[model samples]
Target: MQDKDLPDIVDLVREMGAFGDGGRNRSPGNSNSGYGQGGEPQAKPAPGLPAQSQAAPDLPGHLEGLAARARTYVEAASSPNTRRAYAADWTHFTSWCRRQGLAPLPADPQVVGLYVTALAAGAADNAPGRAAPRSGGRKPHAVSTIERRLSALAWNYSQRGLTLDRKDRHIATVMAGIRNRHASPPRQKEALLPDDLIAMLETLDRGALRGLRDRAMLLIGFAGALRRSEIVGLDCGRDQTEDGRGWIEVLDGGLLVTLRGKTGWREVEIGRGSSDATCPVMALQTWLSLARIAHGPLFRRVTGHGKKVGSDRLNDQEIARLVKRAALAAGVRGDLPEGRRADLFAGHSLRAGLASSAEVEERHVQKQLGHASAEMTRKYQRRRDRFRINLTKAAGL
Candidate 1:
């Protein structure tokens, strides 16, 4: 960084609101916990401290070191999943650009517009036999996804000290036109009703260890309103590591789930169910006791007729697959066409199930979901599966 860019760096850090200490003492560690773990930076570093000097010096060696640390903190500003998604988005954009002989890094706004047009037109590569069984083949990218891709492109350009000029006519007009032309009412995932959940649970093999694990996973996921990532990221012990997302405590009244989500840390209180067969807490206990999981990841891979449980934790995709497999086996959406059935149920169904079926105060439901806004809670809680939206309703249909 040039000496002149130091102030901009300071401003950027200030915007992220991360600086170690009040400048009274230099923190030994430079970790930035974007979650609640990273305590809010309430004030700027006090001037004249040696630590501040380390952060601000312009000498070649010092600048390089500071830049590296800054980069680390910048990357930490977002969740790992989001970073991965952005990286994948960038890769897709670059690959497309390569095919077209266009520069992707310092992307032209015109080219970006063209890319968005291609996406909306479903002009993706037709790789036969490469389609997932459920999705049939590559479909036109959703508007939300295309927009995110644009954002990723813009962010990457900015990181490289270049401007994407998303506001410029070349990009702005095309995106606006696309939105206007393609506007449609939003469609939501089908919420897993309580009965549907029970049916799904029955599909698992209760006699096997894997069945116990799946049963526990489904119950906890529904009760806690956990995201797929949160379900898998949990630890038996407190998730104290920097990467661990959340932890659960078995309490007398219910289980308390303290998780770090996009908004921040929020506590989800899940009470014991009336019946042992359906109780989330009981299922959790049954799974933990059977699996003999005392520490590390709560959910893990079981092998060799469930005799050995691997220490490694299950990934987010596993949760999605598990949900899909159970839902399919149970015929949760039997009325839907076979291929469409696969698209209907996913990890989010558990969360949506709790929101739609639970007879509780809205605030409690909202709190359990860790939603930053009441609107988001209502969106899931509305139960699109059962609720109908029709223009003729107003006409007394």
Candidate 2:
């Protein structure tokens, strides 16, 4: 039925005495007719509806509570890092809107299109009252970053029960134009091979508490192909902390790491290396023994001149810094300038290092990396045997 017909239908129902109070029992000037005995107007029944149909006083508050809970659930649906990025993106967009003297809400497609255009032109970088852009003066944002910001805006609108039509011509056409004009090739981190890893390891002071912890982290991260967050978020055992993302167990055979990653729960097996100096399992055990770390986060802060360990968990950014420092110290990429070499290595270098070095089958590598598809694992294999299949020759040239 058409929505416009609803009010007419209700009026008809009321006229037909569907409510079973046909007014036949009332007098010509009864109080039920919305008039007092003193001939003054009394409170009228709700228009075209019975008085019993009125909503309870608390119903609005109850619905608001449900809405608040729904918002909480939506926030919980994303990882903490994702939520944080989205929040920052929204704040940036809103700050830009303020500078432009526009409303951020109700999501006008034209305004959004203009906003993205400014991002592409680098105008948004210098928008007044906003913090200086991370890249310094007037550098346009990456296409990936622009796309993420758009997603953040859409999600923010949805949380407020508003619709943002990303498919609208204003948004879609501008985004397409931006992509055509500004998209660049993805920059992958330099993969650290086994030799390079050994060299980096050699740069550390093995006797120091910090050195042992860092050594264990690097080895475990490489062997397990673990992301930086997963490296530091791990506990000595399962269910140790509310924020812990995974845990590890030391066994006679190897080190078993159970992690809750983007793809959910998975186990990584890092077997004992050929030598005690290089074994990931041995390094972890040594670090644990020296640090007296029986529980809580596997990696932690080394305080008091690198002699004492702190109870707090280590930050993920430290992984990147450590990798860079060690890479520079070991002169892994001596051909490049010091600044360029430092920029090439990061936490992901360890994961990519293992992927590029493992001589096993593709499926084994994929499984070990906890990648749902072989294609994803291959992306991490920076130095894979590309010509192994010889598909061109096999096709009968």
Candidate 3:
């Protein structure tokens, strides 16, 4: 027969409800609407369509939903820093969800538990070329890090109208298991001895512009318990170095410092000196005069014309390097068995040192350092505890 007169193979198959090669139609019912015929059932529907032939339900967009909910919770937080931290933590959690084939808006409790486990164990389940999950190498996350991540996850989920119930046994079990694990040791505090401070002071030429700036920087940092950012953000118009009678009024007394703080703005007071003096007037006067700073950043870079340039503020990392170089020049040891080099001591050391020195009655060091709790300040206090004990011994106590 001519090809045009021949019946189509597809039509013949549809009419017969079975292929010529003895293929049997396995469908359950003879619906007759593109399905079964005679007493036999039809073939299965195409893969993309719903198995039961029903319309798919629409769901909310994943990232859009997460962002809206995250914004509301973050805005109601106590401080800007907290907002930023929670946002970043949530972002990380969502990224983890994407990696695990889960939706970000409503993460499954089992998946959340797995992510926490991965973070604590320091490795993901899908590592390359491995028969099983492997360790995350030497830098495995600490128990505290894992705990914080879980907390962030829980907080995020709570914001999204979801509750991770204890009935979800995997999450509960993982959290319980982690609680039993020992926490990592606390971090060591940074301290500078009197001689070490003096040595660093002596290293500055004092005859030169940079030397004067360095001297002033160190003295102010020690006297005011100022954070690196606080010191760097100091404006002559806002931060008063001295009162009319020449007494230094550090941290605006009760006024909020608009400069650098964990919460963007912080209320701080000048800490008492080692001699229990309320004012650090002498240190303030000395720095202003030596640095020749009048109306700009108190600490600044020296210019080519031998002038102190106040255009740029010193960054925290620069402050750390400067401290380290000064330490080395002053004959201070940089190497420690377990601790990092002296250069690793950033602006935080100044605040920590002040907290350590201010071991007064009933006044917790955490208050001075602007820490959320005493436990945080204990880390710094422990570093300087030895010096405090030595000073007591020298006093014949």
> How would you encode candidate 1's per-residue C-alpha lDDT over 1-397 as one tens digit per residue?
1221112343344333344334333232332211111222112321111122133222243345676677567666776677667656766775666566565544478888878877766664433223223465566777887789999877655644458889978889988987887766666777898999899989999888899999999999998989998988887667455557788899999888887787887888888999999999999888889889888788889998788888888888988899899999999889989799988888888898899988878888888888878888989975633545565887898
lDDT winner between candidates 1 and 2: 2
RMSD of each: 10.6, 13.1, 17.7
Any residue pairs clashing in model 2, and if so which? none
Q: Runs in model 3 with CA error above 4 Å?
A: 1-91, 125-138, 151-172, 205-210, 239-297, 300-312, 328-331, 334-339, 342-344, 358-367, 370-379, 383-397
Residue pairs of candidate 3 with colliding backbone atoms: none
Best by lDDT: 2
Better of 1 and 3 by lDDT: 1
Best-fitting candidate, scored by TM-score: 2
Each prediction's TM-score against the native? 0.75, 0.79, 0.57
lDDT of 2: 0.78
lDDT for model 3, please.
Answer: 0.52
Alpha-carbon local distance difference test for all models: 0.72, 0.78, 0.52
Candidate structures ordered by TM-score, highest first: 2, 1, 3
